[model samples]
Target: MTLRHHFTRLICAFAVSACLSQVPAFAARQPGPEQDAAQQLALQAQRAQMLSRYQAERAACMHRFFVNACLDASHKQERSALAPIDVDLQAIALRARMRAAEAEMRQVQANIAAAQTGQHDSAQAERQSAARATALAQREEQAAARARQAAAGASKVAAPPPVRPETAPPAPRLFPAPAPQPAPQPALNPAQRAAQAAQAQADYAA
Candidate 1:
């Protein structure tokens, strides 16, 4: 390329750099979908223009004496022109990804909180059940004790009273006591009677 042509290209590059420097920095608030789409469309159009220009320059370079140098210069210009658009596209994509990550994080935190709440409720229910069981057990023990005491009282009431022995005075005598009597003897045999008669006759003779 001629020195004039090179000087002109340098001026164009400087102009593009100046214009890019004047653009506002990335905004604090992320761009909405509509804004992103519009920006992308504009940037794509600019890129297409740059590509078409590069293609024309490439065809022109093929007919020049220093073809490699011409093609290199054209390629460099194309890259320089498209650099800002690429940066804007990257920024937009990065913001979208960061927003997605933040949303996902929030969802995860919500799920964790819900799980903790469920566990707490379950623990509370278990504690209540245990308390009820303890109360019921105490009541049952009291009832059993009362039943035992009642049974004991009933037994005491049903038992017979102890009996006592009594001493009585002798009855008065109805009459005076009688004298003793002798027992009667057996009758004697015939021999004993004859002997007795002879003893009596002898006594008479004497």
Candidate 2:
């Protein structure tokens, strides 16, 4: 039995002892009431009725010739009657405490789970942030390299090619270029050619 059971029994035993110091008018000749009371069928009302009956029995026992014997019997009966109620009370209290403990355990587990989830989420966020930073750094490096290449290309396009030193104007081209010759005249037609021949003969005769 639990501590509560022992305590309840101790208390009920004390109550029984107290009631035993009574007269015959309060004595119980039969044990039926004890049996019925032990069932604790109706806890509050029945237990009260049982206590009253015991008190009446103790009163009746005061009138007995063997008062001590009657009182002893009455105490035994009362103890039996109250035992079931005490056991029931203890069982009920134990069940309630167990329920409370179970609820507390569940709450603690829920809190732990929540804490774990928060940590996991925080870790995931940190990882994402790191990945983004790395990607951004790579992009910046690539952009810088591209900009440098573009600047080099632009410079190459803008600058002119190098020129060599001049020589003595190619030595004045040796002699100057000859003057252009006149074009030759075309020969005359047949009649014009005859006129020109007759003119030459007349000149020779003169």
TM per candidate comes to 0.54, 0.46
Cα lDDT of candidate 1 equals: 0.77
- Top candidate on lDDT is 1
Regions more than 4 Å wrong, model 2: 1-45, 52-75, 157-164, 171-206
lDDT (C-alpha) at residue 163 in model 2: 90
* Tens digit per residue, CA lDDT, model 1, 107-130: 555566676798999999999999
Please give me the total number of clashing residue pairs in predicted model 2: 19
Question: Candidate 2 at residue 206, lDDT?
Answer: 100
Instruction: Please give the lDDT score at residue 139 for candidate 2.
Output: 100
Candidate 1 residues lying further than 4 Å off, grouped into runs, are: 1-27, 41-49, 146-206
**lDDT of all predictions:** 0.77, 0.70
Which candidate number has the best TM-score? 1
